[model samples]
Target: MRILVFGGNSLLARAFTASAPSGAEVRIAGHAEIDAPELLDGVDVVVNFARHPDDMRLPYDPARDVDRRLAKRVSPLTARYVMLSSRKAYAASAQWDATEDSALCGQDVYGANKVASEAAIRRLLPADRLTVLRIGNVIGPERIPGRRSFMGFMLNTLADTGEIVFDMSPFVSRDFVTVEHVAAQLGRIVELGLTGTYNLSSGTGIMCGELALAVIRGHGKGQLRIIDPRHADAFRLDVSRLVRETGLRQTADEIISYCYNLGRALG
Candidate 1:
């Protein structure tokens, strides 16, 4: 299978290409430097992971443009398209376990843009040919401090300050997932020829504080303290459908250990 990957500079892109089996052909194009749809000339699938930081300035919405181009323009040329979406696209309403059956929503600009992209892409590529991976929080080694990258930053902050600031919300919860697992599962999805939306998550809910505590433990540190609340309305994703689809499951401890191990490996 040939894959034209946009935003190939990302660690995930590098990891996917490295781990991808020999039969698959993966080509990458910079999100900002897309041209002629030349990258997808004879590609089977286009996997988009491009998103704006919101702080950055650009012409038109980046998410919409990529989605529209790939779904409308690229999909017509390719055999199929697989879009990387977010759990945020789900309605704020809490379900026992979030599934593809859950409602679609746009809570904020970030999510709203992603929602728009998903819609446009879906319009171009139906659920049968197009696949949407509504991924949960992706954890990895390059946990840059003070950035939005969830697991790494928090863990680094905890290790440095001993008491990291927090916005405690009983309602807020996240499904922790590892980059390794996500890439592996997604690879399996394509290899297995499955279609439709699937929630790729750790399949467990943990608040910011719990994640912090896990990070501390992963670092072999003692229990930590929480500071305050930044925002309300817990953000959680239903991943039952993903488990059913992939027959894959991830535990919070596994993710915690992965990050900690990454930190150790790096240093």
Candidate 2:
């Protein structure tokens, strides 16, 4: 199979390329490189991982940009489209795990952007030709602990200073998936020509404090300091579809271990 991936420089893209089937012909390109019509020729599948809804600068509207790209660069081409969406697109529901059928009433700008993009793709392509993957927080070897990202902040602080000081309670939870798992599942989905929306996650939630402790344990040392005693509610994704279809399962501990190892390697 001939696959074309956008956002080639992204960590997930790199992971996907690395984990792709051995015999599959994969091509990686940035937005600039694949903007032309000729680049779409002979492509069997197009996996888009590049677009960000955060760029609200002039002449770069997220919804409009996705529509324009699809209308001009992708729609005319004969390739299946796989869009990488975020779990943030689901409205906040503390009582239940968000599923594919959940309401797409995301109030945040980023989530709204994904909703818009998904709508546009639905309109532009037939259901059989489109596949949307609503992915959770991806943990991978490429992560670097820093203030910019939550995992980074926790892991980096603990690894570097041997202590983690969190302003919020440690009870906050989120679904985290490993990049390797996502890449492998995506490869299989493409190979099987599966369509429709699927939630890609670890099918479980992990507490922030627990995650910190796991990372520390994995590192063989560190401390967790929580300044706030108030607990935060947890949010999880209903990955039954992915599990039923792809048989992919991962625990929060597994993800934490992966992150810790990556941090150790980086250090």
Candidate 3:
């Protein structure tokens, strides 16, 4: 079976493709060509990971545009379109864990755009054939703990410097997932030909302090200066819908350990 994977160069896309069967037939389409439905002609699945043109930052903007282009290519196409969206859409702008049926409120640019993009895709394909994965923050072997992806960045910095300060409140309640798990589920989704909105997450979350200490313990180094930042709102995704449908669950500790080992290898 041949599949067309847009966002050819994204890290997440790379993980998905690399984890596919060794002999799977896959074609990568550049973001520049996504609007041309011919890019995926004769394809069975189109996994879009593009960024919006407006995103100028090195990685974030480019990824945002990939999805932007994806929203454009849905019509007149007959392939299965699976979009990777974010958990930000339901955040309370502070802290919240929302079920799939919650009243969605898109706050950030990333969240707002994903909400818009999902709307566009659903308009073209019914919820049955079109899949929108509202995903958690993803971590991998190369995750640099001190970089600006917020949590990862801060932790890495503290590890490097041996000491760092950060404001922590009632510990944000967001989950982090691993790419490997996501890839496995993506394959299953294709096998079943099922489509619908689902939350793909770690199934549990770590408080800010817990996440920080985990980094320190996993590396056997660093001192975290936990500051008292007011209770920042966070979003917890209820992935039970996905669990019931796909039978996917995750142990946060295992995923966190994977991050540590991957970081060790990179270093």
Candidate 4:
């Protein structure tokens, strides 16, 4: 199989390339090449991880729908199109996990954009030729602890002052999956020619406090403190479909271990 990946610089793209099947030929296209029609020639599948140039810009503009534009261009050239949607596409329903059939009720701008992109892609291609993956938090070495990301803020604070503070309780939970797992599952999905919407996740939730503790323990120091005992905006994805189809599953323990090892490796 010949696969072409856009947003080649993205962390997920790197992970996918690293673990791509041996029989598959993978080519990466940066922002410049994404617009080149020739890049789509001879590509069996095209995975898009690219973000619109206007993403997160203060004055939001719907006209800058890059995902839709990319889809329109690539759908005609490639046999299969895989879009990386986010769990943010779903609203925080504290009651239950989100399944592929769940409503796209998220109010966040980012999530709304993903929802729009998904709709546009679905309109452009049939179910057999398209795959939409509503992925959860992916943990990996994409960002160093001291960088400007969520993991960076937590670990940096711990490293600098030996204390990690959170506005929510430690029990505030969310789903997290390893980059390796995502890469592997994506490989399987592509090889099997599976299409349709799927929630790509570990099917479990991990507490925020527990995550901090694990990283702290791995670093061999640091502490955790929750300032607010308020309700947690927790969410989880129902990955039964993914598991039934791909035989992929993950545990909280494994998620914690992955974070711990990441912390240790950062030192």
Number of the top TM-score candidate: 4
Task: Residues 1-267, candidate 4: write the lDDT tens digits.
Answer: 999888888778999998887799999998777568687889899888788755543333445665676778766664788899888888655225988888785547777777777887788887888999999878776445446555767777777778788888888788889888999999889888899999998878888888888888888877788889876667788999988988878888888998898667646
TM-score of each: 0.84, 0.88, 0.83, 0.91
Best by lDDT: 4
Model 1 pairs in collision: 98-238, 166-228, 167-228, 167-229, 167-230, 168-229, 171-234, 172-234
Better of 2 and 4 by lDDT: 4
Evaluate all candidate structures by whole-model CA lDDT and list the values in order: 0.68, 0.75, 0.67, 0.80
Worst lDDT run of 10 residues, candidate 4, spans 53-62
lDDT score, residue 254, model 2? 77
Better of 2 and 4 by TM-score: 4
Give the poorly placed runs of model 3, Cα more than 4 Å off.
21-23, 53-68, 91-95, 143-147, 155-160
Q: Write the per-residue lDDT of candidate 3 for residues 1-267, one digit (tens) a residue.
A: 676778778667887888764556888887577567477668777787776645332323424555545645655666777888777766454225667776665656666666666766676675655888888877665445334565456455755676546675636656777778888777677666768888888768766566666666666666667668776646567778888877878887786676556434433
Name the better of 1 and 3 by lDDT: 1
Give lDDT tens digits, candidate 2, residues 1-267: 999888888778999999887699998878677457567778889888787435432333644455447534666666889998878778766224888999885536666677777877787887888899988877665436344566767766766688888877888877878888899899888888889999888878877777667667767777888788776545688889878887778876678777667656635
| Superposition TM-score, candidate 1 onto the true structure | 0.84
* Alpha-carbon shift of residue 52 in model 4 (angstroms): 2.6
